[model samples]
Target: MAFFQLWNSDHGHVLEACKDSLKKLQLDYLDLYLVHFPVATKHTGVGTTSSAVDDEGVLEIDTTISLEATWHDMEDLVSKGLARSIGISNYDIFLTRDCLAYSKIKPAVNQIETHPYFQRESLVKFCKKHGVSVTAHTPLGGSAANTEWFGSVSCLDDDVLKGLAAKYKKTPAQIALRWGIQRDTVVIPKSSKVERLKENFEVSDFELTKEDMELIKGMDRKYRTNQPANFWGVDLYA
Candidate 1:
C-alpha cells in the first residue's frame, strides 16, 4: 500500500502506526510505500487538509517540509525493515529531478494522475530515464470525488470512446485503462463497487490495437482533474 504525508516530526510515529496496522491486518509487509505528496499539511485522521488552488478553484499544495528529508525518513523505514520499497506520489518532474539528485535510494515508483487527456509524457519519460516506474492514478479519468473536471471533459462522453468501447465489447472506462497498460504503466482505478472492481482488473485478458492506441492518444486536451496548486511557491520539494 502507498504511504503519504510522512515527515521528520511524525515520521517515526507514522512508521510505527503503519507497522501496527500491517500486523493487525495480518500482512507481512507493504509491497510499496509512497509519500502521498511532496509537502506536509494538517492531518485529520488518515487524510490531510490543503489550501492549494488553481484556475478552477482551491487545492492543497505539497507540505513545507523538504523532499530530501522525507526521503531520508523513508529510507530509514527501509533500513529498519518497515517497508520493502519507497516512492513518491503526485510529484512533478522538477521535484522528481531534485529527489534524484540527492536521494540515497531512488524512488521505485512515481504515482501520478495519468489518463488519455493528461498523459504527462514528459514527466513519465523523465521517471523512466531515471529508472523509476510510473503508476497512473485515475487512469480511467478523474474519480467521483472531483466530478467538476471529469464532468466537463467530453472524452468520457465522446462518441469516439463509445464507438471504441462497442468495438472492444468493453466499457469506456475499461478501454481507457487498457490504454495505460499498453503504455507500460501500472493503472490503479479506484472503485468500491465490486462489479466495477472486477471489470477494472479484467483488462489483462484483451489488448488494444496500435490504431486504437493512437486514436486514444490523439484525444489529449491537457485536462487535469486534480490540481492543488495553492502551495506552488512553497519549498516542498527542496
Candidate 2:
C-alpha cells in the first residue's frame, strides 16, 4: 500500500511523519511515496471518511508548498533510502512541468484518475516525454466509495462499451483497464472483492484491436471525477 502525506502547516514535518510511519509499519522501503494532493488539507489517516475540503467547503489545491520544495524532499527520501522512488498524485501538466524544471530526481511516476471515460492523453504524453511513468488510479472508473462521481455516470452502462465488451467477450471494466495498459500506463484498480481483484489483473491476456481502441477513444467524456472545488482559486493548470 502507498502512504500519502498529510497537509500540515510545515511540509517538513509532514515528510518526517511519513518517514516515522514507514518505520512503524516496518516497511524497509516504499515502492512509491506520493503527495496526496496539490495542497495540504486535513488528514484523517488512511481510509478515513473525511473528504478533502477547505474553509469555504470548496476542494483545496496545494500549490502553496512549492513543487520544487516537495520534489527536493522526495529526492532526499530516495537518497536516504526511505523510499525507492518519488512521484506525484493529482498533478496537472503545468505543475508537472514546474517539477520537471526544478527536480534533480525526476518523478518516477504520476498517479491520476485515468480510464476510458477520461483518457488524459495530453498529460500522459507530457509525462512520457519527461521519462516519468504514468500510473492510473480509478482505472475501472473509480470505486464504490465515490459513487456520486463514479457510480452516477456509469461508463459500463454505455451501449458502446457494452457492445465492445460483448464482441471481445470481456467485461467493460476489463476493457477499460486493457486500454490503459495498452497505452503503456500502469493501472491500479481499487477493489476489496477477491473476484474483482482477480479480474482486474487478468487484463494482460487480451489486446484491443485498432478499431476497438478507436471506439473506446471516442468515448472520452473528459470527465474529471476527482477535482477538488477548492482549487478554483489556484492556477493548477497554469
Candidate 3:
C-alpha cells in the first residue's frame, strides 16, 4: 500500500506523513509508497492539509520544495522501514528523465492517465525504457469524471471499444482494460457496483486480436478528460 501525501511533502513532512499513515493503517511497513502527484503545495501543519489558494482562487503552490529533494526523503522511508518501494505519479517524460538521472533510488513506477483515447505512447515507452513500470489511472476512461470536469467525451462509450467488446462477448469497459493490459501497463479501473467490479476484474480471461488492438489504438484522439492545468489554473503539462 502507498500512502499518498495530503500536502506536497518536505523532508520533515514526509516522515511525519509516513508515521501518521502507519498509525492509521496499524501497519508497521508498507510494500509500496508513492508521491501522488509531481506538484506540491503549501504545508499547513501536521494532522491537517488544506489546499490554500490565493484571493483569485489559484492554488498557492510551494515553490520552495523540489522533487529530487522530496524523493531523497522518500528514499529514507525505505531505510527507516516505513516503505519497501517508492514511486511517482503524473510525471512526464522530462520530469521522469530528470529523476532517473539524479536519484540514487530510482522510481519503481510512474502512474499516469492512460486510455484508448489518450495513449501517450512516447511517455510510456520512455518510462519502460528506463526500467520504470507504468500504472494507468482512469484506465477505463472515466465518462462521469470527464463529463463532470472537462465536459469532454469518454472512451467508455467509444465506438471502436464498443464494437470490439461486442465481437469479444465482453463489455465496452472490458475491451478498454484489455487494450490497456496489452499496451504493457497496469490498469487500475474503479467501479461503485459489485457487478461492475467483477466485470472489471474478469478481463484476463479474454484477449483482443492484433487487429482489434490496432483498431483501438487508432482511436487515440489525444483527448484528455482529466486536465490538471485547467483545474489548477496552471499548465503543468506545458
Off by over 4 Å in 1: 1-17, 20-28, 42-64, 148-154, 229-238
TM-scores for every predicted model: 0.80, 0.84, 0.93
Candidate 2 error regions (>4 Å): 1-10, 42-64, 149-151, 230-238
Better of 1 and 2 by TM-score: 2
Q: What is the lDDT of residue 154 in candidate 1?
A: 32
Number of the candidate with higher lDDT, 1 or 3: 3
C-alpha RMSD values across all candidates: 4.7, 3.6, 1.8
Candidate 3: worst-modelled 10 consecutive residues by lDDT: 3-12
State the C-alpha lDDT per candidate: 0.73, 0.73, 0.81
Local distance difference test, candidate 1 = 0.73
Clashing pairs in 2: 38-62, 39-62, 58-230, 59-229, 59-230
- Per residue, candidate 2 scores C-alpha lDDT tens digits across 163-233 of 87898888888888888888889988888899988988887778999888898889899876654443434
lDDT by residue (1-238, candidate 1, tens digit) is 6443343233324566456546656776676778776665433333223343456553333356556776887788788877788888888998899988888989999999889888888998899888999999778777455466334353567676788999989988889888899898999888889998998888877999999999998888778766544234434433
Q: Give per-residue CA lDDT, model 3, range 103-201, as digits (tens).
A: 889999898999989999999999999999999888977768667877878888877887887788998988898989998999988778899888889
Best candidate per TM-score, number? Answer: 3
